[model samples]
Target: MNNRSQISHGDKSRNTRLGRLRDLVPVTSAIVGIDLADAKQMVVVCDHDSRVLARKTFRVRAWDLGAALDWAGQKAATAGFAGVTVACEPTGHRWRILGQLAAERDMAFVCVQPLISAWARRGEDLTTDKTDEKDAVIIARLTAQLRCYVPEVVDETWGRLRHLGARRERLVVELTAQVQQMRDLLECVWPAALTAANYPFRSTTWAATMTVILDRDGGDFTRTKRLGLDRLENLVRKEVIRWGAEKPGLRITRNLFAALDDRAGVIAHRRGALERVEFLLADWLETRRRRLEVEQRMVAVLDGLELTELVTSIPGLSAIGAATILAETGDPHRFSSARALVKHAGLAPRERSSGTFVGRTKVTGQGRPGLRLAAWRGIWGTLRVNPVHAARYTHLTTRGHNRLKPTQAQAAVAAALLRQLHAVIVTGRSWDPDVATFGSRRRPVEVAA
Candidate 1:
């Protein structure tokens, strides 16, 4: 059976080459893209070659999503796909629920950058004619062409804490607005009160005292024999007596008392609301602090390798910064070289060359924003503590670089810090600022010890 043996050898060779090509392209066996809409979603499934295998539009509700996933899974099975990956543009709260559901099913899910997708689609036509179905197809094609990392499923605790943080921010904003409104109202009736107190509506003690002052009647203020009048006078005297009889201060006090007596209902309502908000905020702050501590502890335990300790040796880098870099980059070995790490950190300048013209180089913000922000913050903090970094910053400012405008200098420092961090993590050694800067021309002047 020599002919049979030859056929078997040829088939194995062809399969090996096909596998290499697939690896180069980075496409999974099957991929689905979702175009999120208010009431529904448009979904498209594609094979490895970017050919649409199945397409459908479905409702964007919880139950509907379950049904859609089942359908997609069945279709994928029938098409002989190894595994299914889904991509969608996040629409805030609308897509979070669906995304979580998708993650729970162990299916790969990625949130495509909206701007990148738009730019990719722009090459298709001169006139923009976008629809849900077209967007779905485009998204599917994008996933096939450019393999993206799937987002990790966030823990329920983190989600709950994040929601709490958002709610707290909203409440704080509302409180500020209400306080401003109250101050404006008080100023309109009694400018003296506004001036003497310096906008005391924001102070809890002042608000409580004002609540009592405002509830009094004008008759009570004019009367000398009534208990309520005496109480009102005593409260005002206690709160504002520090101002003495200074005309500006006394005038403000008198006008405030008058306004309180006139608009008792509004003042009392706002004061009560402010006190309630303050109480809730105090409780929330305590809970948030406790939760944050727990999260930090958890992170420490999860990444207890020597890498974290090594990264902490850097002047400005902390555990959180180190962890962020590690999590974002996955593994240091993934970077074939140090320049790969630099490019991934967005610290490397982008090049554009065409014929005889080479365009001005600029830092391409193509990497993780969280990592970039952490690096910048670490560099700034290090400059404050590390003499070498501070000297570098000072030298940069003195050499015709505007001291007030030091963003580029900061970025340079961040790049240096990142490089040091990577070295420290990889080598399991503590970082020494002096040793690290020994060979660099940008090294600061050394002082005799």
Candidate 2:
């Protein structure tokens, strides 16, 4: 096993020691922790030593926010603090407005992980009682100990892309559910219809044939038979051509006849079933159209952003995929290093082990799920065509020891892709295959003699 996979007690101790030595926030700074909620927020102010100086609750509004911060600033000034550090748990979208306001006012806005705050609350108090006031104090104490990080506040372009990407994800999920529901309906009403193509919905030709059967003929395969193979083929061909799909093949027409001949005839309530299918088809089509529009908007937004062309220089990665990944990541230069970028995507490898028993290693999954998904999908296309990713994946899965499963290997490749994307964007350099897979089984570069 790789030494990194095994976490020993000494490692934990060393990490704790290092964390204690690091002074993330100045001791003279005042920490303002706000327990955020939808309508109102509970705020707490503490000095460097975690002494509660004041506490207040304010409604989440423009004037209210100003008053709350102004009150905290007054308290800090009275206590002779050097500066104010605003800290909060990422409570939904409530923190962004506060963080932005704090930024505008030149206050250091930092974030504490929810899990860390929760643990900190329980570790010392040993109580199950939880309240907003208590949580705000905990946040302030954590901030005092430098257990918070500066939150990333993306600018306008990235904000738009993130929203678009989220919308696209929802549309895709709805489209998938619609497709599955339609498939189930087909299975019940017309069993043989599914046999026409491997992925009927994905193929426009198959979709055209199904549309005619469902809409015009009222899900009546027998009417298609009465029309005979020649006329049936002509009708399907015309429909396919109208939809800009491929011409119907002889096998496709034959399959329709074969469906009619099958022992399992049309199920009862076939007309009602076809009507539902048509409704679902219409909805699915609309969702697909919306998704395409979102993708086009993403491309346009990407074109306006810097470093897009450099990121897209990787072989086989589409502009849409790059856009989604970039939107999720925001500004790559903000990340301290490529590994930090991978960790932000939740692709960081984690291990669980005891004194004698070794456990399976897996990803931390502690960061943005959307970013992880986009990175995985973004790198998927490059696995076959991109030499660097292909070689890295091969070496990871086929190595002598510590061989990873296909899924694990794919995730590793995705993390590497994220790291490479970050490196390229930060350095303002195009992707180089050799630089990506430095020690892998790449062919040696040749020079003319």
Candidate 3:
């Protein structure tokens, strides 16, 4: 009998529960499951009846990775497995190497999410006994039961770009903090410097100018016939006038300048540091711009393949938002309907009930944060340009649905947009704004007394 035809009802039920777990899992004579750790790993092989065939624990090293793969291959061969399915817990970065090894050996591997393992352990009777060996058995059982979805292997390019984007965001945040700190320092000495000079200390040109000011001696500014004094005064006067410095402000500014002049080297050093930060920021921005271009091109290709035109047609969803929805969710077929998409987006409300103690409805927020944010941003944009959305927003507020404020209204709009996006992708048709009723007003129902 063919392999497909030979699958039993028990196998069918397992497959149904896990959604394609059986197809992904090899129906072998033995299944080897490995639980990865920092120093060592525990491995267990189980049979069709979930009986442990063999088990071992080995240290992980450069040599051990190869040995582990070789050992697993030999065990499968000895056990007469037509094929083997290897299961492992992806602990830290240690499991990454094992995953790569599994791929090289052409063996199916199921990665157990850390959260699932923690939750499983919480429910166990022997919770106090937490060992590498015991955890390995739990991992094997979890894999045998197919308790989690297989994580998609991110492409090299996407992974690299994502890292770059993350680094860029971090640097931007750091730069902002540094700029704010510099502003605060300047405010302490030269509150009027900010008001009078109107030049941001964070800017390159202004930093250079501040360096010049900080280097000057108070005696030089007070000198009557000196050229340096004349030049310094002229610069200060120009800045003061530009910044709209009053007579009283000028006195305060000059006092601060005089005090800062006492510690000229400190201010000069800060100026140099600020200049370096600016240079680094420029380089990072240029690099990010290039990477962004590549990401945009990649998104365009994927968007075309996935029929994301209708999603992009929604008022607030730009290319990035549409691409994010496509990349994160993959094909919408996994979602049975638009309602599934809404729940997945976390736009749907949660309900609580206990006999007569009905709890207040609240957003579950149990979906992708990135998708939720994209939807929120899109809705906000739509409300601004689309009069229909704005009117609906007003209606929701006036009707005591204040909890469903403008932001909530936007989420609802985004949910509606997803429905259109799903239809366009499934039906292979362009989005019809009229048919979508994206911003249309709902007719009020008449009450029968």
Q: How many backbone clashes does candidate 3 have?
A: 0
lDDT of 3 by residue, 1-449 (tens): 35778997647655574776776664663567777766777788776556676787887652367677677667767787776777777666666677677788887767887778887877666545677776777777777777755655656644543454444345445655656665665544344445434445433334433434544432232332233434554565565443234322244344334444343333545555434444543453454455466556646555546555656565555666565555545566666566667787887778899999989876788777756765665566667765555666767666763446656666666776667666767767665555566434356689999
Worst 10 residues of 2 by lDDT: 16-25
For model 3 the TM-score comes to 0.62
Choose the strongest candidate by lDDT.
2
lDDT of 2 by residue, 1-449 (tens): 35786987657655764464244356777889898887788888898677889888887763358678888989988889877888889877767878877877888787899999978978857676689998998898888776777677688988899899999989989988999998888788777778877767777666666666666667566777677877766777887775456676557656755676664535676778878887887687678778999999999998897656987898978889988898888888877678778888999988789999889889999789999999989877999799878988998899998888899999999998898888788888888877787723377689999
Candidate 2 at residue 242, lDDT? 57
Q: What lDDT would candidate 1 get against the real structure?
A: 0.61
Clashing pairs in 3: none
Q: Which stretches of candidate 2 lie over 4 Å from their true place?
A: 1-24, 60-63, 222-254, 261-266, 306-308, 351-359, 439-449
- TM-scores for the candidates: 0.54, 0.86, 0.62
**Considering every candidate listed, which one attains the maximal TM-score?**
2
* Per-residue accuracy of model 1 over 1-449 as CA lDDT, tens digit each: 27855666547645664464344334545878788877787878888677888988897664367677767877888898867777777666655766767767877666666776788778768877788887887777776765333444445534443344344334445655655665555544444445445556533334434444444432233332244434555665564433222222344444445544454334434545434444443443344455456447535543555465677777766665565455555556545455567777898768898999989766787776656765776775688887778877777667763452378778767777777777666666688765677843355679999
Query: Which ranges of candidate 3 are over 4 A from the true structure?
Result: 1-17, 26-29, 48-50, 61-70, 73-82, 92-97, 153-172, 175-311, 321-348, 354-357, 367-380, 386-398, 401-431, 438-449
Quantify all predictions' global Cα lDDT against the true fold. Answer: 0.61, 0.80, 0.60
